[model samples]
Target: MEKFTLELLFHIIGIGAASGLIYKDNSLFVIGDNSGFLYEYHIDSQDLKRHPLIENPSENILKKEKPDFEALTHFQDSLYIFGSGSTPKRNAMVEFDLAQKKKTDTKNLTNLYEVMQNFSSIKPEDFNIEGVIFEGENWYFFNRGNGISNKNTLFKLHAKKLDQEFSMTSIDYKLPKIKGVRTSFTDAVLVDNKIYFLATAEDTQSTYHDGEVLGSIIGRIDIETMKIDFTKKISDSHKFEGLTVYKNDNKTIELLLCEDKDTEILETTIYKLSLNLK
Candidate 1:
């Protein structure tokens, strides 16, 4: 197995620490944070630009006691943001068009709040969306169930019909139970017919305020067999959050892993891992 190497470090303050990344092209990457901020950065130049897609400029939106679980993805030339918030403001999936010159705001595509209002049987607090990955006509979402449980659940959203309600279901993969460990699957990407995920495993032996113990691993989930193979683990202090496959010269495939953490305080670094699928 090949190890990941740090390529660059970026300092972005008050960004609420990035949680997800989406590579639009060879140059541009869209990053999302817990603060509802979406930033566009250049890979080649290493230049950073910030855009607040869901800021409450008027201070009208209800404030929460804790940070929300935010994630982003790009599909059909538009950026999609997903997160969970307070009541009447529960979890949501939104879309933004980046092609426009003006800063684009997020539009509610899937409103868990509305669903909760209509269906009293379903609770809004139960939804905690972490990340979203689009595969063909299906969009897979990773939801971290209330922090109390170690279960990292996956939900399927049909991309073809936006008007249709999103159906929540459990993924077949069984997560390993490690004592004193709080594991949550965050983001995922598809490469060579395999699904690679980024997850967080917090050591519960330490206090919740003691800071998160983060690590990353590369795994392959065979769609046909519904089996997962966690073959390689990334050894680095920087938490791996997002990943995208890019083609270098001679058509060689390079995997760019986005390190989503505060640079000034945390060991923020992006790693480039070369894949040799045999």
Candidate 2:
């Protein structure tokens, strides 16, 4: 098996400040860290469009601060958007209605947030969340913690029948320590029978605030066992916050990643990663 290769494909001003990516309706949707709209692009064309805010005040409790949505995924034709829950923004999820072209249900996830919060080792103000994937009829949520926050947890919850109620069980996850900056999982996708994760580290004291862009890489874990398998370093000092994994031509593994450098008005970058699974 050969290693995967990543290449910088495109750069856009103010558009690629992405925190999450999702593929639906034959297009790719990228969500920014602080924005209320979703950036939609056709798969093989340059046509890009902006979708309305997934969270509307009428359907949602008016939040004082803009909700920093981080992770996005879909299941059974329904699209889901989740907030980072690392800040004063309350934990929340919005379900999109395709027929109505708007958000249908916006639910508060206080219980699920409290569960993950109590499992943290850092101060209550420092906790953060960045990823989620649904596989095997279970929802997996990944939390990214730094040296200051000092905690990282993977949670699994079954949502077959429950609407807003979440009973998350923490899964065992371990990463070899990295020098200089703290590392944690940012985003993930399930490919084949394995779940791949994009782990990143930035020079920050707490996970709640921005830090110097330091490192980014990819790794995978066994779905059946739910344990770490292998990790490969793709960048030592670049920050990639969004990931989309799929197979093209029935033989090649392709990844779309977006970076957020915490810059003021600088264009964010999107990279294309290709590898052979062997």
Candidate 3:
């Protein structure tokens, strides 16, 4: 692996760290899996602001409980945030109209998450998802597999309306595993129409939530050829959860990698990763 400077962007003080990241409107937004609040960071001013998801006022899709927001992305003029559905909760997506900063749509993705959770071979905890990317008219949902029976399943949803009524297709997408190591997809991003993954392996015994951090990697999936490559690996202690492209010069691009400790540290981390992929 080439040496890249891991520049700290923002250490989330108090509350929990971020599970997903999105860069839009000259700002960076991070989501908490335990909390439904979106932490916004201004690039130029370095201002950190917290905003709560406005409850969908309509009783038809009104949810009293805060969904565990896991994935964040931007499409057109709106920002979409998704819940993990780790425990079969009302898996939904909250869409914010960036032009108005108002919750404009509420999508119930329970049918998608519930089917994966209730699969005969996978357990509810093993069916967790953290990686999601919106490209073209399809939304890619990656389940964080524990290397047990699951192989980082990927669900492609053809979204016509950003909500509940979409067709979904699934496939078992596998990442490269170190010797006897079971890895999972933490997050993903699409650059130049190609998909790159933030793959990390933890030393968990498959029956736990958090585990000893082992290895981290930045991988790529050539959608046309349908090939998954583990191009670079990071042997650090950081449990990277989110990834976004920051700078794309002629030669190298800066990858913004965010970390979630999953502990009571009251702080989050973002590292600027530089990769010279020719």
RMSD (CA, angstroms), candidate 3: 4.5
Writing each residue's lDDT as its tens digit, candidate 2 over 1-278 gives 25778888777554635788876656677777666766777757767766666434221223347577788876766667788777657477777655555667777776667767775443556566788887537888888766464566787887763365656677645554455665788898878778878888777777666677667778878988887888777887777888886445547778888887654353557788886766
TM-score of every model versus the real structure: 0.73, 0.86, 0.85
Question: What does candidate 3 score on TM?
Answer: 0.85
lDDT of 3 by residue, 1-278 (tens): 36556667656564365678877767788776666567778878878776667443211121235466767777788777888766546377888777776677777777766765555246666676777888658888888876356558777778855544677667676666654566788888888756788877787645235677777888777766646754567645677888888888747878888887765455677778887766
Candidate 2 regions exceeding 4 Å error are 12-16, 54-64, 98-100, 119-123, 147-149, 161-167, 177-179, 248-251, 264-266
Q: Give candidate 3's total backbone clashes.
A: 1
TM-score, cand. 2 vs. native: 0.86
Question: Best by TM-score, which number?
Answer: 2
**Which stretches of candidate 3 lie above 4 Å from their native place?**
1-5, 10-15, 54-66, 115-123, 162-167, 205-208
lDDT of predicted model 3: 0.70
What is the descending TM-score order? 2, 3, 1
lDDT at residue 85 of model 3 (Cα atoms): 67
Q: After superposition, how far is residue 195 of candidate 3 from its true place, in Å?
A: 0.5
Ten contiguous residues with the weakest lDDT in model 3: 55-64
- Count clashes in each candidate, considering only residues at least 3 apart in sequence or on different chains: 0, 1, 1
